[model samples]
Target: MSNHARELAGIIMNRFDAFYRRFLDITLGAKVRFESKDWLGVQLAGRQRIRLYDHHVNETLQAVRDHMGGAPLGQEGLKALKQAFNDRLTEHANPEIAESFYNSVYRRSLRHHNIRAENLYVHGFIRRATDPDLTPYCWQYRTNTGALGDCLRQVLERLQLAVPFSDLTRDLGYVDRYLQDHGPAELRGGEIGLTFVNTLFYRNKGAYLIGRLEQGGLQWPFILPILHDDQGGLNLDTLILSKDDASILFGFARAYFMVWCPVPALLVHFLRSLLPNKADYELYTAIGCQKHGKTEFHRDFLNHLHQSRDQFELAPGIKGMVMSVFTLPSFDVVFKVIKDRFTPPKEVNHETVKAKYRLVKQHDRVGRMADTLEFTNFELPLHRISPMLLAELQQVAPSLLSIKGDTLVIRHLYSERRMTPLNIYLEHATDEAVQDAIDEYANAIKQLAAANIFPGDMLFKNFGVTRHGRVIFYDYDEIAYMTECHFRDIPKARYPEDELSAEPWYSVGPSDIFPEEFATFLLSSPRIREAFKQQHNDLFTAGYWRQLQQNIEAGCFVDVFPYRRRQRFRFLYQQGNDKPGDGASPP
Candidate 1:
């Protein structure tokens, strides 16, 4: 039995190495894809990368089952297997991730009751070692000896990009001026240093150079979004300074960045230093290791449960017809389970709902959709669950839950970052805040549409407000691709009775959507209606949606800046180019 366990551990490690190599191979193509401006290729690569983990896990699960002769490993066998796995991980570059892969294999190969430290890596056992001889993942630069502009030039030159900058001198001038005006006061005459990640982070149509600026004892995280201009030249689109804005750039709403790192653990460590508020799991997920992130989250959550006494209760918001959500008050994540039966008007089955969440996982979120971590055979202690919440779950999603002893096993569920539901947010918001949320709500719709996604149900309850005040869509039960939908304008009323009828007189197909009726359901408040009309009146017309569909069909990639427009140095430079007091600067 011990020999077989050792052999199984070796096989799993071999499988992990293969997966890691393939992951890096796919990640390496991101740089070439960005240089060639292959936006479609970027999307394809993203979907493929996201699918890799599960593909390998399923394959390894089959291998493990075959090796074990399709029988469960008893406690002694499981203990021996875990020990062998840990023994093989001593010098591993990413032992935490490898342990996670083992956990996935164990979880899928056995029943839920088999979950234990003896069989799975419930918590990380391998401590990361800092090798003195290992190469650093960041390039360090000192601004103390040279002009800031000179140091910036060296940083750009070090990238050794496949394409040349559009106008390095001009961009440097803009950076200099912007820093002189908006940068920290201490940066002007104080000693400063910059540390940038060695590899560029690629996602969608943009590449970002992530770094930190240090002066005195303070550190400010910064990001430079590099873009390919219309003239086929590379240009730095904007400079993002401050931790708040940097965190937004890495917000849970955005798609993962494709970053190739030889030493992923070291890279995550470096990123943590720059974004201290971000968790290790978030940093790993942002860099495209979502499976590992899920593992880290599970470990952290269990640890929190052990430390805290908070009970799991129903998440505060309008009840979801398709998903039953609950959370621990002290935690920032919500666990969502698909109900056995959805409420009327939902019209979706369990498999379909899972498919929609899968779609969200594989699609480009464009910073307007939340990312979810899917899990199966998850368990929780029944005692920690509030009685009210337990009764609610048993009522709606009983099919997904089973009470075995003191443990409640969830067959499957998704975990997502918690945010204030948009409807709940608007209830207490001041007039000004309501107006801002309304505008942001409209902008979220436009951005999702631009990315070729249509929120099938655009009610306020379907969206959420992030900590940064950005609105994002969270409901996946009623989402569809823009190209998959048929946008249509309502015909003029043929009779007085037709005008007053609650139901439309015209025939409607499954894929057909009437944009004209959107305002009726979306804008109930007069203030919200007027504010939405001021900025997004065109959203109510079918023409706007049709144009977006056409653009998507033509393979046009829309520019969606993660940062605000005013934060862009190019716009500021354009403002300066215009004559003073002329008011000719672009919005």
Candidate 2:
């Protein structure tokens, strides 16, 4: 051989060795494992085994060598060769081939751990395709198949496309037609009778279908079930309910959506804006009951009105009077309609009691009558009163009364035949008298606090004086915890070192309030100013006000009460000036 041929032969041998080493590394522990000893002694094996095995190995090695020629192995060249192998493996491991092999060997794997040919092909493909030197499987697949090729076709066949809104309507029509032709009688009836409502997707609330039922030319509102979505869309899986049962399922679905939905607080204002005058009144009444039923009349009247609407008519009675007394669980409100036949009383004296009785009796024959001469005490539960009712009472008479726990007892201002004296005085009292009354009220509150019983609401209206001038407290939205009272001087600007800012201001824990503020708030009244100075003046000062402010900010409003100051009323006869039996008046 010439010098060139010898160099070529050496290069070829080098190429063959490099290819064999690379192939061994890629295939090792997979199809073949090359022990160093076996690789060296391959030719020394017996004839039959040696001839068959060596021939196969030599043929594969020769093919690799020829593919490389005498070319010096470069990074690009090695990469190309690796990629080619991966591509071939991937083709053999395609799903069509894998599926066929899987079906064939699935039953055979019962006893032996028989591996399917598809799995073996896939394993080999993954091993080869994942090698760093190889081109990516996706790139190879794309280049080989083109954009509109087999892989794309398979994906399209597997995925169900979303239908457009227009298409959906068309399909729904087709469904109706199909039902008409072949569906069950019940299904056809449902389609015709039930209306298909529009679907909505609320951001926080979820999906809902709002439909109206048409029966006898009347439409009723209905809602569908709530729907949730991970990758949110109007996809089939996101359909909360099927069209067939959309009507029946809408109610629950609507409720769920409304409950879970993120509604803006301002929506309440928007809704109010749309309500008519009467509707607005009704809504106001409803919300007042739910939010502010602390006042007796508001709570009692609302309850009574609801009940009366169910039982009575609006016309006047034969006796020329209509009387209605309504009672809620905690309070009562009475409405009287008097006919022109009876003379109205100018003053609420004992002589006019018969007229008052007859007036109320005309409206509601079963209503209870008020005993102006006696002191009535009744305990009621708190939950029965609505907050709106309290608000209304506050507006009507802000300083005439208060509520404590469930009882709403009012003191009579003077003897009244038609109206209670307390009601007449409250309705007619001058603003100055009201203010003076409020001042005396403050002093009474201070005394009540000293008795270890706090009148929860300190509003001037919640306290009233009876015919005998005894102060009484009513309105009990918050009561109890009187025994836990502690008097402290609250600072105005500075907070006490012991007070923690962590607690809520409305319901601050007992230990958190500064006693000084309680003293300052008590001494704030002019009626109590001189008395407080003479008796408890040292307790009320600038330091006290500061501490009280801090406690108030910290939610110590309850601690400001004079818990020990509850007053006991003296009977009229006990005072030696009244004409009554054993200090008790006729009821």
- Tell me the lDDT of model 1 at 354: 88
Q: What TM-score, computed on C-alpha atoms, does each candidate reach?
A: 0.95, 0.20
lDDT of 2 by residue, 511-564 (tens): 333444545454455544554444344333435334434443453322111111
**What are the lDDT scores of the predictions, listed in order?**
0.84, 0.29
Of candidate 2, the 10-residue stretch with the lowest lDDT total is 252-261
lDDT (tens digit, per residue) of candidate 1 on 162-272:
999888888877777777778765565657888888789999888999988887788777678898876679888777777778888887888999998866778887777
